[model samples]
Target: MKLKIINSDKILYEEDVFYLKAPGLNGYFQILENHTSFISILKKGNLKFKNKKKIKKNLNIEKGILKVNKNFIIILL
Candidate 1:
């Protein structure tokens, strides 16, 4: 799936990820390939993703919003 993370100033990350884990307001949730579409408010916590190469990455984020549509995911911080 395609993933993009952006803030007011710049794009923090943009790539194709195999899996994603994000901090939602209620709890943490994971998104895998071909996941259903939805939107959620994020809390202050860590955002993680695994790339197609199977390498994992992490980002410390403040409050943000996440949107999933089709096979693309976008995070606004």
Candidate 2:
């Protein structure tokens, strides 16, 4: 799925990712290929995603919004 991370200034990251794990208000949650679409508020923590090559990455967000639709993930920080 296509994953894009952006803030007011610029696009932080954009790529196709196989898996994603984020810090939700309640706890940590994950997004996978073909997962259902939803939007949620994010807490300050580490945001993680694994690319097609299985390389893991971490993005730190202070607070943000997460939206998933039609296999596209958008994180607004």
lDDT of each: 0.95, 0.96
Q: Show how many residue pairs clash in every candidate, following the order shown.
A: 0, 0
lDDT top scorer: 2
Q: Name the runs in model 1 displaced over 4 angstroms.
A: none
Deviating ranges (above 4 Å) for candidate 2: none
lDDT of 1 by residue, 9-69 (tens): 9999999999899999899999998899999999999998999999999999889999999
Report how far residue 75 has shifted in candidate 1, in Å: 0.1
lDDT of 2 by residue, 1-77 (tens): 99999999999999999989999999999999899989999999999999988899998889999999999999999
Question: For model 2, what is the alpha-carbon lDDT of residue 2?
Answer: 97
Which 10-residue span in candidate 2 carries the lowest summed lDDT?
52-61
- Determine which window of 10 residues in candidate 1 has minimal summed lDDT: 47-56
C-alpha TM-score for every candidate: 0.96, 0.97
